[model samples]
Target: MAVQANFENIASYLQQFSHDRSIPPLEKWNPDYCGEMDLVIKANGEWWHEGRPIRRQKMVDLFAKILWKEQDDYFLKTPVEKIKIQVEDAPLLISAVDQVEIDGKQYLQMTTQNQDVFVIDAEHPIYMRAFDGEMRPYVKVRYELEALVQRNVFYHLVNYGELYDEPNCTCLKLHSGDAQFTLCM
Candidate 1:
């Protein structure tokens, strides 16, 4: 199938980047934009190149690490080059979640497809958006990139929510690492 072939190609290409947990300092890189590429990350988290789907999970993981956003545009950046790419929605997807309590404070952590861990705290707040025709949740990742919190994960997150009344509206607030977030209004 074309999908499988694309995956193989992607896997080979990913070896160029090497698998490292540390994200490259893309913000510090001042590379010139080398025009647009035929790469696209679908809303469902599928990566495509030249209109073909990249089915390899490893390749997707590699690309996720180097992804960045400026203003409203998305790009794949490295120390030497920057290539513009298209993202149908959030650049990353929160595929799993874990919660822990530290000193009576609750901390919520999310794991992305590439195994990047992020704490849902003041520095990384969660937001909800209406996409297509339904409400989808998102969380700030590094720099200007955001990860879409998956449906099942959202359901799990609601278990810790508490209702809070404000001057104009009542919202479901949740806590993670001593940081409180408004889940819904």
Candidate 2:
């Protein structure tokens, strides 16, 4: 009974931001722990629940809205409930990138699989990690969550990377305005 009521409240709150692109104020929510959910965000950024894939884009986007992270764990949070969810790699994937130049400064903006846009700047920096001798890149999304930069998107970013001369050696760096993010060591 309480779980049903909490789900109703969560649904109502989600409805309020159904058409809005801005993310809901999840940080302000103080929901009760609703235990673990079957929801799992796979390494490829597919959302699943009850061992089945969630196929509807709109529904997936709605779930992504309520996604929250706490000290390395992911949860679907609302004003009345906080349900833990499994994340194989990242909560989302960087599906596309849009680059622009303003006043001679370059800006790289990336869009997540859930349609959330983030600019690669100080607040949202890109980091690369080597896994099995392959380079994997990630960009900070929000709420301490990061989106894995897809392979094709990473190749595109490599085209924009410039060779920078550091004090010790030359390294490849991606630039956005005055901020320079080293792509490689």
User: Looking at candidate 1, what is the lDDT of residue 50?
Assistant: 86
Q: Which 10 residues in a row give candidate 1 its minimum summed lDDT? A: 1-10
TM-score of each: 0.84, 0.86
After superposition, the stretches of candidate 1 with alpha carbons farther than 4 Å from their true spots are: 1-17, 102-104, 163-171
Clashing pairs in 2: none
Q: What are the per-residue Cα lDDT tens digits for candidate 2 across 34-111?
A: 887767899888887778898988778888888899998999898778988899888889999878887877799899
Error of 2 at 100 (Å): 1.6
lDDT of 1 by residue, 1-185 (tens): 24344434434555776657777677788877666777899999888888989787877788787788999999877665567889998888898888887787779988988788978887789987788887778999898888998888877777777777888765668888768888663
Give the residue spans of candidate 2 off by over 4 A: 1-12, 130-134, 163-171
